[model samples]
Target: MKSDVLFTSHATAKNGREGHVKSDDGLIDLDLTMPNSDSDKKGSNPEQLFAAAYSACYDGALNLVASKEKKKIDSTTTADISFLKDSEDNGFKIAATLHIEISGVGQEEAEDLAQKAHQACPYSKATRGNIDVTLNPKAV
Candidate 1:
């Protein structure tokens, strides 16, 4: 089957220090900037984009799974994604940590939903064996 939706990524100046990405519909557009040797960054980077996508995707997955289980999520859900550069490999590999906060739920309930959402998320499936991802579910 074909995709339900398609996104086009077009970047104007990615080779330079700063660039921006735009989707065909302008729904996904952001400026990207790289950190210099001093570790200073101005605009968002690719890691930030990945983090945002993961968080949004995970949130949607959680919502879908919760609804399927006839559970009501009265509060908001948030994801804190951390991108870690492999020191051993010298940035050749990347590791990620995802902390999901599900409000209006107990720790056990939150964790259960989070685990199910991880299995449901496309991003999670895409990065499953490719990158090391640590998931921490929190009730807040």
Candidate 2:
């Protein structure tokens, strides 16, 4: 197997438990705030980061799958990712919804291609059985 390119990032303290993340390639600039237990300000935490990453990765994977299947997928594909709270664990949960508007494909073929994409997508495979995912195709 060929070696893959490695990426590195560092997080610096912004102020009082908050920080900013910077990648070595200068590509990412993210401000991170810790969850405040006292104030109950737990929104936009790590779960949101996970959701964004998973959603983008899944979309790219879907595009690659479509290309390999000789299907045309353009800018019409939309993906929404939701991160919910796990009541039992008091943690976060993830759910993904995908809508594709590919032209010249029947519903059955589109569904099959989507299923294949879901299986082939790395993020989908990684989160399988852990998160709820919904795939909808607007092609007919």
Candidate 3:
């Protein structure tokens, strides 16, 4: 069986040199503007969108991985994805730090599950060679 998910965002002009994006879900309303043409602002601009997408995708992937490993993860898994600029180029990097706070699971077991989750996550795999990922777990 195959499944699919979809999301949509639309942009409209806000001013002379700015615009705003509104999604159907209304979870994000972002402003599009140039921080500076030759500064670090460009790479920093699109981070919020990336972070939001990465966090949600990683969590879902983690849940699947945990299930496959016969582990249970409830509503306490948290993820923080930070976008950092590459010092050598005019580009950016991603740092995904995941915190899974669950009961009835040991640190070793949780860590092992998390490693599998990271490997299974589509976003993590897609950006593996291009980005940085860090997983942190807190046992409850």
Question: Per lDDT, what order, best first?
Answer: 1, 2, 3
Cα displacement (angstroms), candidate 2, residue 129, comes to: 1.3
Better of 2 and 3 by TM-score: 3
With a 3 Å backbone cut-off (N, CA, C), the pairs that clash in candidate 3 are none
Off by over 4 Å in 3: 1-18, 24-27, 32-45
Under the 3 Å rule for N, CA and C atoms, how many clashes does model 3 have? 0
Alpha carbon lDDT of residue 82, candidate 1? Answer: 51
lDDT of each: 0.75, 0.67, 0.66
Better model by lDDT: candidate 2 vs candidate 3: 2
Score residue 139 of candidate 2 by CA lDDT: 66
- Residue 128 miss distance in model 1 (angstroms): 0.2
Who wins the lDDT comparison? 1
Q: Give the Cα RMSD of candidate 2.
A: 4.7
Candidate with the larger lDDT of 1 and 2? 1
TM-score of each: 0.75, 0.65, 0.66
Candidates sorted on TM-score, descending:
1, 3, 2
